[model samples]
Target: MTSQTDGTAPAEEFMDKVFGDYVGANAIFMAAIGDRLGLFKDLAAAGPATSVELAERTRLAERYLREWLDGMAAAGYLTFDANGGRYAMPADHVPVLAEESGTMFMGAAFFDYSTKFGESFHALLEAFRSGEGVRQELYGQEAAEAIERFTAPWFEHQLVPVWLPLMPEVRTTLEVGARVCDVGCGQGRALIKLAQAFPHCELVGLDRYEPAIQAATENARQAGVGDRVRFEMHDGAAGLPGPFDVITTFDVLHDSADPAGLLRAIHDGLKPSGRYVCVDINCADRSQDNVGPMGTVLYGLSLAYCLPVSLARGGAGLGTCGLPEGRLRAMALEAGFAEVRRLPVDDPFNNVYELSL
Candidate 1:
């Protein structure tokens, strides 16, 4: 290590932060590998075991498994028992790494997000130089599938029970068999859940990505809601068929290149008495104001996915963390919305709004 001379405190501090980030990056990737290979799940289910034992259990190569298990141990993701010559995931950490459908499941998903960023790094570098955004398609199928797994827990647990109940009127409308549309509905998990929850509501899922739309269609068919829920590969800025009783855009509004135009389309497509529901990154308007862990994650995600895709389309780039409530309300108002009411709910990542025309 180089010795720090006088007046080098700032430089030393910066270098230390960089070194820490480097380690963190490697650890995240290793965690993702463990998740992908079902190593964590096996550990959680089978208790402490040697790398050789784990290799046999998972039918994977022992040499790679040994190093991965060591990495997990060094990262404190797993406990090393020298006395027994075995390694195990801590019981408390099991849910966070292995239970994809549960609330505590976050580590694996973040790893997926990190992997996507790495995949797009080259194009993102070009976009940074050109001042243009990376195209959404460049993110590719693996990233898309990873994102679905990442968001599944929230859509599965919170969307219907916690969020929908916040909008009693809209919930009642859906309960009574209203027409519903989900804009930018990536893989259609939300639509499928909604269909299951409210079978009478006619549902439509829309996205510009054909691959995502295809995945959504397949998911709907598998979920046995294909009859009631249909998907379309349509751009939101082009406007939509009219008079949907309830419309939703979850964690997607800020990703739009023309959020105002999309909002206008949403407003115009809704029935006079219809409701528009959306969830976007919960952030302060100013970049400097976005602080703490969640804010850091949001900004990282912005650079990785949201900001680049909007730029790819040569549209308004409202980087993920840029859309604070004030800006959101203004955009909605400009789109002829009568009200932009923030729904009362507690969430770490998203702010829910109920818009009316």
Candidate 2:
């Protein structure tokens, strides 16, 4: 009897883990299908629909569609009614998936990753074998640029509010007209934001992708900060061009293939005792505050997608997991930053660390 119970427990545990993976894998496909097929849109318009109704309206096979709906229901993504014979997205959740504040929009990136899941796994296998993954296109320069563009708003919206209070500190160092280098400045969002807020400051956005630099330049122009904010292509891995008064990176360090080298370059690029501010995923539960859903999602992507992409690209990319302020401070010391601190960000959903060269 003990043997029977013991065997069953292990089997159940294994099955549970497998089930979790299966659901997560299939959810990625379903979410992508919903976006591409407009299935979710149809449901939104009709208010609620049975699988049969959805299939007929969508011109999909009812049986097959029902299976997908069943999975969605079981996974808490779909709500079912027995008396009414309908399935629907929970009313409260619909807005989140459909609206600007939704995790679903940001989650769209995961589908792209899911489509190339096998390649990542294979590259991971190779990495484990040789401390390296095969040369691959999964997270190359172009892909990184695209990811930055797609995720920038999602990232900025969450973190900017956190950084607002620190503006005083930022302004103190920049002296209202000092130059600031936004290294790894994807699309120049930070520069645009800063320039808009502090019209007198000079912001230079440096990135590796020409297209991204162009986009950032255009965006800065659009934001009416063109004269103050400029975007240029820089080999982010090599360093920044400076003597600038301040330098900042928004979630850039983790993506570098050689973070130590990049840090050293930035150190050399800055003016003496230049100020630095960085915002990234809190890899450590330092806050002891459980990260909200969006933060959690970014953290997961950093692990399952970001790090692997780095390894795949033959770089030493890794997510910071919002590690403790002290851990970041330690790295800054190693990187030759003079003073380091972890500051509570003014942004509603982001965290910040401040350092000096």
Candidate 3:
């Protein structure tokens, strides 16, 4: 009976955890709605306003804003001034949700991701049963564009100043006007940054998605680097035209249908002295080693999005968090890279690697 009680306790405890997660997810959904509707930003700017005041300021319905404000207050995202009958976003929370360009801005990104996940849930369910998933097209353009926006803060703020400078040689190569290609360059944020930073370097952004390429091309034009920065609709596996000086793929290799083939193609296209820089999720080779909320979230994303897209292409699906250093090193070596060295970077979610032939 004592042993039965022990087993039963664990089951009950697990169920408690599951219920807590459901609550957390609902809160996130409400937060995302608030973000999408600009309720949080408005409240933050107005400083302890009633739901009616917030609605008046934002031109939204008072009834909906009232309900949303109450939900946020209960979720602890907003503090309720019970005496004054008002609500407010805590000062500490403002930067996280409102400051899109700041490093601390994560709420908007997570909101975009969660909303997209919710939209894709049905397609994901079908993919689980059939082993053939919906493509990125099914998520629609908004979701596709959200990915670029979500990652823009880091790319704009860190890529040029912090990450690129880690490899002095690569930095020097780009400074000297070399041909550079960004494979799977969604929305061309990174490439645009690179183009602005190194005007001498010729830049090419490639993605299989035409919508992304179109966006990227327009983005470069808006950034005033369109003369030197170009976008191409091409699969990474098909490879770029040869003798390129530097090739970089930010969080893209694992998303490939044929990552190994893509690597080989990258190697074949590069000049003898050229280098390949890959940025991907920071993860462990074993499941047991990944022990935390971040790991759980990444694995959930793998199941919902990353794994499905690659599998849908009838290719080796190295899901999100699947490319640990050891596996990546092995694949890089097999693809004719003589060396694979990890660069020192402080990013919590990603690791950078420099591969050379």
Clash totals, every prediction:
0, 16, 0
Where does candidate 2 stray beyond 4 Å?
1-6, 36-71, 80-87, 101-121, 134-136, 140-146, 153-156, 171-175, 221-227, 285-305, 308-327, 345-351
Instruction: Give the residue spans of candidate 1 off by over 4 A.
Output: 1-5
Error of 1 at 313 (Å): 0.9
Q: For candidate 1, lDDT tens digit of each residue in 91-113?
A: 79988988878999975458788
Give lDDT: candidate 1, residue 24: 90
Which tens-of-lDDT digit does each residue in 1-357 have in candidate 2?
336556687887789888977778787777656644666667776778888889889999898778877777776777889898898977776654444324445334555444434545666677667765444355455444435544555445643454545656666665457788888887777788777666668889887657678888888888888988888877655767787777888777776667767777777887785677776555445544546655666666665555664665577665545334555666678988888766764443345777775
* lDDT at 157, model 3: 84
Model 3 alpha-carbon drift over 4 Å, by segment: 1-7
Which residue window of length 10 is worst by lDDT in model 3? 1-10
Report residue 180 deviation for candidate 1 (angstroms): 0.4
lDDT of 3 by residue, 1-357 (tens): 336656787887789899999988899899988887777778777778888788879898989889988998898999988899899888999988777667888764677777776677888888878878668777788778668767787786888898888888899999999899999999999988888899899989889999999999999999999999999999979868767999999988998999999999999989999999999989999978877898887887788678888888897888988898999999999999999989888777889999998
lDDT of 3: 0.86
lDDT (C-alpha, whole model) for all candidates: 0.89, 0.67, 0.86
Top-lDDT candidate index: 1
